[model samples]
Target: MSDFFLNIVEDEPQALSPEKVWKVAVIDDEESVHQATKLALANTHIMGRKLEFLNAYSAKDGLALLSAHSDIAVVLLDVVMETPEAGLGLAKAIRHDLRNFHTQIILRTGQPGYAPEESVITDYEVNDYKTKSELTRTKLFSAVYTAVRAYQNLTSLAAGREGLRKIIDSASTLFQERSIAKFSEGALEQINALFNINSDGIFCVSSAPKNPSPELAQYLTQHKHVDLSEVDNDFRVIATSTGYRDLFGVPLQQIPKKEVRQLINRALTTKSHVIEDHHIALYLDTPSTWQACIYLHSQQDITDKVDHEILKVFASNIALGLENTKFLTQLADTAYKDDVTSCYNRNGLMERAIPEVIDSNDHAVLYLLDIDYFHEITEALGFEYGNRVLNSFADKLKDAFPSDAMIARMHSDVFAVIVPGHGQPPIKRLIEHCSNQPLILENGDALRLGVTIGLSIHQEGTQADTTPESLIRHAEVALNKSKEQRRGSATTYDESLDAGSLERLNLLSELRRALSSNELELYVQPQVDISQQCKVVGMEVLLRWHHPILGNISPGVFVPLAERSGLAYELDLYVLRHSCSLVRQHPDLPPVSINLSAMSLDRGELLDDFASIMERFHITTKQISLEVTEGCLIKGNSALTNLQRLSDAGWDIHLDDFGSGYSSLNYLLRLPISTVKIDRLFILELKKTQHAATLLTGIIGIILNIGKRVVVEGIETQDQNDFVANAGAEVVQGFLHYRPVPFLSFVDEYKSH
Candidate 1:
């Protein structure tokens, strides 16, 4: 040991080496203890740095000083002070309350009796515990030195955790609500941030699933030539004879593939991240697909031991974040999807289709489809089952068409599909597909559901105003014409269809005013219970609107228009309230059936409105039957919940048009409905089509099996009446039964009968 005196021959404080000074805080209750501790640790150099002593006389004062200087790194605490266990309390407070667990704590006690040896070491979350009397000058110095080194390790770990969190947050924000190009750019930026380095990166999704050795050889093209396929297990000098280090395409040799596969097999495994040499890999195991990220860097420092630990923590968080992002993306995509056919929805079409059409250099074909007589199915089986029928029909439409076709649900039982650069052959294939298959409902009933499709191709010389709305209108006109012919067939765009669609739009605008002006009227179609020898049971109300200028308008045209304009709710409510009032006015009338729109049911006010109307009219619940279609019931859980709510309100629930679209047998059990109406298509084709006969019989069997009553609609002939009666259908309604007439006309007809 050399005797040293204070020699202040030093450089300016600013010019002094930053590494030469270390600030040490000595905390003890006794002033003598602090002086003694400082004296013993004076002029000490553990790792080439001279110590400067800091003193705190009590635990309270020491904590205040510790908080002010978080970079102090190490704390020396005395166990006994004003309180017997002040040091332990301070340590607990720091670790839990102050969140300073990363800082090192060393406990020294002059009164050894106050601090138990084994308990203090184990129970308190301090770095070391010692008796101050036992701590020699050499031992004290050694303890302080050890504590500082440990704090450095903890600081590194904390920084790593924080860095990983920031990177994940940044990546997540970048990917959220982004386009494909932006997503690619964001991914590259994230990768650069992950490595803490600036580097150019490109991503390409290959047909091949696994990482190939050729990728590395391909990356180093400028350095050397190498054949990846020619060698196995043996290292071949590829790109660098220039002493450049090279690693395999995948990192994580420590986590052997066999071991990873075993870990994956053990349970529902999440993603894994691993590091090796100069690369970091991310592994994800999706059903039938294994996606991974293989990152490569030129510097060896990128995979240091400390960096490797940090990489592992980063990988775990990355896996979770990636999983969350992917799931969120899928969920967002589903929001813009049509559940039945898994096609784009109307919203999706409007967002994506118009832009695509605008960008097209070639002619694009737009085809709008309407399922002919779709109402008959929902009425026959109830909306719950009927929706399944529509879904089945939609599935057939999707399968029959090509994958590249941009298909969307434009409205209930209606679809608009866009085919870009579709020549005659592909369009013919689509037409053939539509012609080939009839949708099969869940009840094992086959619906030869006819589709009327309208096609419009934007020509090269046509005005560039081929917007999605215009294309949809063009296709719709063709569809209406095909429907008018009672044929489930395809029609290409003609100028006449465009003119007709424009007229239809004008008609819709006018129809909006019809409700307020009392232009709407109702006709009663008598529902005859044939089992009671053609006795009148209930009457179904049909809406008719006659424009003063346009003359008589079809419900088919105005009804859909009303639904689209968001006025269907008011129209439906008015009809129900008025219908109930009519029943009250004429005590001789039986229960009346009124068809409800899907949109009206979704409003959640239908039940309350119905209840109020019935209460006001002083009518019993048995006098009203609410008719709803199958398309309305199965849109989502909310729809099903609404149906349940309506059934609970005591109105007789009738499945308006059954045997039409997908009739979900499941809904019969879920819904509390009393009546199921057989569609008129089956009744109309009873004389000619064997397919129609089989479908009608199958639908009847399903209804009877579920204990629901059946009403066969569209009986226009004595033969049609005989056919429905022979099929064991309990009720029948049609023009032949008696054409729909006004209340006065109904009275006149009933009086004569």
Candidate 2:
């Protein structure tokens, strides 16, 4: 062995005083054989265990002795005693007959002629074979010591293998416990898998008295029944009823004492052993809040280097796993939760919440809310600011819904909430809240923001299904119906609303082909210069669609339909180019003003697209007037900028259908324009509503004062015409003169007139 190994073996203190020496067996029949074996092995020591010799004159006597004391490890036997193979027989008998597996048997021979060296070792089951003359003092001690060491290795390997098997089995058993009740029961099984040194009731205690009340954070060495104790804050005796006092032979030292404190402080700061005792191994972590110690029984001396590594790894994995489980659980909770709104995001609603709502047995009142004119806010403020608005709106929605209610963000500007055991009253309250809450921007701009809400009550046994998605669709239908009412109110979905939505869909599809099929025809109504004595100065182009099957559809229905379907730009371009062409073909016709939808005003392609079409028909910009409604200009600076771009591109800009939109005056002054065509609503009650007449007069005066022309639309009677003329309006265009006609009919009328 190396010097290091020799030092380790020598440093091991004696666990017990020199008691009854380990007995040795000598089995030989020769008269001097007994004396020779005793003389060779007498007063010998191997691994700190002394030797006491015992002689057996025959195989029978040795077997008898082995049966009495089963702990004998080494035996010296002579082979050529009674027969030439007596020792081999005795060795085999000891193995099979007595079953002394732990005993190491050695064979000794006096005559080499009877038992050859190689043959005896291979044939005999003894540990070693030696000639009687060569059995000297040192060689005999080496053989006995080598045999004892082999026996110790076998014992330790067997114990280690058995302990590992028990540990795996314990871990498997703990994995199967179904409830918390079995956790404490399984704890004993896990601890029992650890190697036990002696019969001290599975643990040991210190002799020193445990200072009952120690100072804060002082290390304590005491008998603790449970190492993983949360309730026992101080040190206490473990299993006192079992045998704490009897096994320890001394009381334990109390924690928080000055000596214990110093030990703890030293343990935390240094890498060396802070407490060297027979009971436990102490370790303190200064970088963290916890402290720990491992108890080692006196009989279980720490020999292997692997023990400390195992304990440290086990401790770290346990702590990390506990913390990881907690962190993951909290993270999962917040993942489904929306912090600002206290509602679910779309993913949570679709995956988790919808299943819950479906399982509910009670009737659910579902409301789908969409902010009316939300695009205006996004256009006025930036999108980032608009997101803040939406977040704030979501918070209000959460407040409006009950605590147990389910709410979700459905779309960009849409939200959905469900209330149990409630119906229209709650939906009405939500609508009122939406309408009443004025959105306050960061710039101190307050807007009376309103939302159109759709409500549907899904109860059992109804014709409609109560699935979450279906309920949302029903609510969306109601929202469309409410929007048609134009009051920012709540509406319930019904069969009629479904049918109306389908009809609108059909119309939208047909309208897609209306312009391409040449089904739409433009008709001009002359605006007479009554102030210039009935002379025609400008004509308003009124749109008329003649379906091949359905005869003349009103502009009011198809016009708005076309605007929403993105086809109004085509119709406006057609009217502007065709009207200008007609005026160029007939020089007597004045500048024709065609009514344009708000969508056309927003298109950057409007002016250039129109000029290209006019150039195709060989017409100048002065031949046609591009007219946009007051609603177009009311959309803020984008409308004004586009109008100014068109005017700068040499197209006449007229504010057509004036006095129809809210805040029209503000836009009228701001937009670039050449004329104002007063809406028929302002002129319909011109004689009946005196205030309408005064408003018209004031509007006309405002237009003329700005050096712009004023065309009073819907003049159906001479009296209406005379009323407008008397009010100093320069032009008049209405059905009293002519309704919209086909281009060929207008051509014939112009040629004949």
Candidate 3:
């Protein structure tokens, strides 16, 4: 990574109160806003919690922070950055991509016109919408507090709901325990942890002897602590929150309070519960062999009637007791194992496999395998069938690896397995089996599976074995690399891949800087009207980067770089805005055509921005032309609609790179295009292949027949220029006629003309 990207790394946040701090993220492009927000919210508290601020100066930085800090309670978001909708885009990413629905997003904007409050609120789950100008320090503080409270309330409700669910599950499990003594203990613990209380609970179990002396009965009822040798003979405390360790396994009768003994006896005799102001003793409806009672205490009142009733009903049902151990195992399995496949899940992998790999003295290899086109399969077949297929896959995995080997379903169609030692993992064989072996579903539908595997090996005593997180991360990177190459391919982690990624990030950082600096410039190449003795007709605008160290960089290098870096929209807007300014300044210039990416058109916002730019520059649509390729047709309805819209608004639309594949004659006739620029490849290949010249001539003739003008691209020789002129091309753009010149030079030339 370059120093430019280093600027995004924020300083470590100072520790707030560990137990009672709401993490709030400030995501804005302005440094002043970050400082003001920090000052305004310095001492602000909401829901008995002080605020801890995490600042991100850009939408990209904000997203990275959100991903890292899942505990963020609220996001103070600005509505514009590189583009008008950058903040909105980040909000969508948070909800859909990050799967973070709980974080309250208070959308703040400097310019309200760019974002309509009603629509943005409806669309992006905005909690509170405010403009920067209206946000007085006091109002800002109040707004944050309100949103923070909403976040706290929402999370509390979620936690409470989850707690209730666990309580019900544990309560049901309590009744299913086979042993009467164990059953009482389970109920006592569940009641203490899950219900509306925060004090100790004790469960006592008793079994009457067939024949016993007075001394024996007295000794069983009240004596010493229970231990390994002691058996359940009479009533005894199974569990209690007695502070002294020595009192833990002692007899229930040893407690100083007379109510404790009386309460247990009353509940046992009545076969019900004895409730008091501070404590409740419930009788366990266990087997006839043994009797049990659970004594619980609450410092606070059981205000909720429903909770009280549920606890009583829960204590009343202990007669089931069938397969208790198995039921508990399944409940535990649901947490760590996949519900459908019954294999380990991601949590299971982390707990069980990560430690093994880090601790093992033997070499270990981790395989991250992905099933290709799994989503498509689910879409075509039903999700039920997809689950069945997953079950089949899990079974195969079990059969392939040893029982002790760690296998887990990381997520969706992705599975991971760590095979410790050089045991010959049989990974290749497993892939072969999946490919050749058809999975016969419950409905008799058979489908074959294809797998892609990414492997990361950890040699014992190597630095890689120190951290399982890096091992897993490397495997994920390898998986992405494998998929990028093609599906059903295998890849191993390599350091070069990381190097290449860092290089790309550096390039992206540089490009972002170039966009703002004067390092980027638009150049123009004149088009010729051959019939008018090769007179200059129009010009096509081109973007170039003049890097400080590496002068005159190619568009081929940076154009796709901008697209991949999520800066394509910004770059397109810059070109359109710059071209409009050029046309505005030089009133004598012909319609200056500029390229707009199909991606921008499909985004559905850039067209309006383009219109706004034109209106700002006082330039008519006729003064500037929008050029696109066949890629526009496939980018869906938005691109096609926008092309027609621009043409209808009196802007010229030229279909650039014609016959570069994907262009159809039917589409050509239907689309509202005035000019077709044949791809440069034909001109480059004219001398090499006679078929090229024939094809070029045929395409030009067909374009002219439709009443549309043709622009022959990439001509370098007089022969090629003359050849295109005779082939019905009205306008010719190439080095042979007029080489590209800087925008400033083009302006000077026009003025001189």
Query: What order do candidates take by TM-score, descending?
Result: 2, 3, 1
Write the residue-wise lDDT of candidate 3 on 1-753 in tens digits: 000000000111124454778899999999999898888778775545678999998889999999999989889998887678889889889988998877889888897555554766666667777789867775576566546544543454333354445543564355444344465456566666666466567766553432333544454354322231344435666555553234456676686668777887788778777777777777664322345677777777654522654554455333222122222333344456776776779877776676766586467778898998786677556788789898888777777776767888999999998877787456668778767788776777788889998888887666654357777888887887788778878888888777866777788899989888746899999998888988888999999888888777789888977875678889988898788777777778877888988778667676688888888999888788888889877766656788778788788889999888797888778999888989899998888999988988998988899898888888889898889878877788888878889988977877786
Q: Estimated TM-score per prediction?
A: 0.39, 0.53, 0.52
Worst 10-residue lDDT window, candidate 2: 1-10
lDDT of 1 by residue, 250-338 (tens): 22232234533233222222445444455443443321121334233335545553355445454433333333333333434555577
- Lowest summed lDDT across 10 adjacent residues in model 3 is found at 1-10
Query: What would the TM-score be for candidate 2 when compared with the true structure?
Result: 0.53
In the predicted model 3, the residue pairs found to clash are: none
Candidate 2 clashes between residue pairs 3 or more apart in a chain or in different chains = 207-250, 207-251, 208-251, 208-252, 209-252, 210-252, 210-254, 211-254, 215-256
lDDT of 2 by residue, 530-565 (tens): 777677676677778878787878889988777756
lDDT of 2 at 657: 72
Q: Identify the candidate with maximal lDDT.
A: 3
What clash count does candidate 1 reach?
A: 23
Best prediction by TM-score:
2
